[model samples]
Target: MASPGERAGEPSDRGRPVNDVQLSKFLSYICRHGAEKKGLTVQEGGYINVDDILELREARKNGYSVSDVQRVVANYPKQRFSLRSKPNDDGKLQICANQGHSLEVKGLDLVPILRPEEAPVVVHGTYRRAWEQIKKQGLSKMSRNHVHFAAGLPGEDGVISGMRSSCQILIYIDMKKALEGGLLFYRSANNVILCSGDENGFISTKYFEKVYDITKGVKLDY
Candidate 1:
């Protein structure tokens, strides 16, 4: 499905093309959660070689080429991924998810949030039922590597990713209490606050400064 002027394994000559949402999902799965299962070696920081991805049967069947990958990444609205050429310069690129990894990404590029001032307003978005469960057990990482947090409320200026738009409740973490309690937090490339919950994989409610029913625009009694 290459365009007349577009060629496989080559960069496009003009402006970036519209992103392929389906391809985005495919790459997200492979780099963020399915590399090993898909028979690709995910390197540190969740990177998989571009050439290897193109070799996947599904990719080939969809006619995805190197240019398609680059164009899609270039046009992606969110900072969901990073694509880089190796120092070896083997005419191939490596791709990785910026955050939201369902798998371990050891040494992933993240900024340490050492003080409350660094991320003054940290929140997690969820619905009512889940919030009720979170109220009892606190926040759990669930299956992911870390609990994801938003630097600012959804749709706020400079806050582009993390948390879904349909969330009915917003749980705000008291960064001061969380940090004083020996919890760790990092800022992902997409500006998400990644919290390494306690040894039990949960952030106790004692660290929550505020919980609000955002749908109703009212603060809930914690």
Candidate 2:
């Protein structure tokens, strides 16, 4: 039997040696091919592509922290890394069509201030009508307890249950801004008031279904 010193000299047999380049190539292949084969259409542009897993593994092998890989992959060429544990359903809002100048909604407005545990209020509507409803309700008016009836509560409303509740709203826009930013839809667990924004700030128009549908189809160039 080998002595303790002899055994210690032998290469560690615990883990496989990681090849960074090979791992990267494997990940890239997984990202491109796995997506095509699986028919995983791009949504909000953040997920674990094959390369991400490889990079994460290779990071472990190199004695580098997994977090380092996470940060790098987060800013990866394709925007492929996300710490978000859940799939993001938020959609983009943009100018209705070629008739208007190119415009994108401010992403900050929709970013979540609360976590899923908090259970905020959410809402959805066609592009044109979102803003009109918000203006009619007034932001300050919405915070009060008994004012939700003004927004037309549903008979089987999923978000609002008890007659009195305290909640914040999360809004999403479903209009196209560009070809890549297709017709979008927003849904949240909380009670949110939808609104429209002029590529600059929230606009006053209430987008209806026909208008939103046409815009969505037009953005896809249907």
lDDT (Cα atoms) of all candidates against the true structure: 0.82, 0.29
Candidate with best TM-score: 1
Worst 10 residues of 2 by lDDT: 93-102
Candidate 2 has an lDDT of 0.29
Each prediction's number of clashing residue pairs:
0, 15
Among these predictions, the greatest lDDT belongs to 1
Q: What does the lDDT come to for candidate 1?
A: 0.82
- Tens digits of per-residue lDDT for model 2 on 1-222? 322222222222234433333433444443323433444332232233232343344334653334333433333322222244433434321111100111221222222222322223322323334445554542222222111111223334443322222223222222332112321222212333332233333332232111222333432111
| Count: clashes, candidate 2 | 15
